[model samples]
Target: MLVRIRGAWFVAVGVVVAVVATALLLVTRAGADTDRCTRFRDAADDRAGLVTGVGADLLVIGDSYSVGLGVGAAESWPTRLPGRVRVGGFSGSGFSRGASPCGDVSYAARAARDLPESEIVVVEGGLNDFDQPAAAVEDGFERLLARLDDRRVLVVGPAPAPERAAAVPAVDALLADLAREHGVGYLSMAEADLPYLDDGLHLTVEGHRQFGDLVAGALSTARQPGR
Candidate 1:
């Protein structure tokens, strides 16, 4: 289907595809009844237990997963970041669906129009594009990164979700290549020790904390002296 979002015409990405991705995205959320990540959950006040670093104002552009669907604002990972964090992205967004059906602006376009001053910017998505054609995914990624060329940015590849176990390598490689092509930092969460909810795709609160810590560490390391 052709979708016009934020003045751009998008074609080929499927609503059903995005829907399936959303389903997978939720699979790893809470209430799955098989999650052990929560077995190690700390008290509410223990939110700082994961890891903390010198916070920096951060802009995170991602999908529902990044926005913390099914979770409270304070409990969302972005909110947990040790800095001023602004979270924005459509729930089922992806590179392929840049001009989203829901009228959400594409990340690249959003950055082009208005990217707030921040220490770092995170451009995340793609898990929702898992089933999409690589060509389209790359096209979208490239367009977005092109607009972000002037910013200190990090490109986070998709995580290793059980549902995408087999295709992880190719997708991860594509994302890594894209990041390298633009000379931006890239983080591979495919093999990271993040705890997935139940559907084995979405991340639990603890998982978000861990991921946030990872991002924070990377940001810290990036600002370190010449290495």
Candidate 2:
């Protein structure tokens, strides 16, 4: 009986150790991912002349869609945008949550940071906040708008993806409502039929071009007299 008890205790200890190890591994991986994101951001800044602290005509703060994660820099939508544009995009980031798959960056956090000066600031990407509570997402949007109170701000709602189609409209509606309440211009892509990659989430190069043109046109329209 004593031997059996000892064996059970040993098995229990092993399970505990395994759980601890798995947790450590996850933490380590998360830290590594965060570090990688920081490096990528720094490199992007260098490439975009942001390292010089020079401002651009437009500043876009968003997630992987803005970064053109799977495509070349030139193929990214921001590059297709007219005039000088600076992009602040991180993967797996959203307004309501941080410490995501890519890093601890969130839209609210990005807005709170000292951003480069720009004539127009566009806050994009809220799809990641789909699973989060409505109250949390609203709070995040409020915080972000509060930070950019002095800037000409536009809120771009996330486009629909085949994989997440059901959740897109809710987020889009919430963003549109918030934009209206905050007196900011809001663009809704909930009904946009854009090409997507195999994952049915990220946009293709062609999709980027389409999106860029749409936004460029919107900007032009907004700039017109009596707009």
Point to the candidate with the largest lDDT.
Answer: 2
Model 1 scores a C-alpha lDDT of: 0.64
lDDT of 1 at 166: 74
- The Cα local distance difference test for each model comes to 0.64, 0.75
lDDT, residue 23, candidate 2:
100
Q: Which pairs clash inside model 2? A: none
Q: What lDDT is reached at residue 158 by model 1? A: 78
Q: How far is candidate 1 from the true structure (C-alpha RMSD, Å)?
A: 13.9
* TM-scores, all models, native as reference: 0.67, 0.81
Q: Estimate, for each residue in 7-117, the C-alpha lDDT of model 1 and write its tens digit.
A: 343333566678888988777553442332232122211322222234566777776566565554455666656676676544556666533444334566656666666
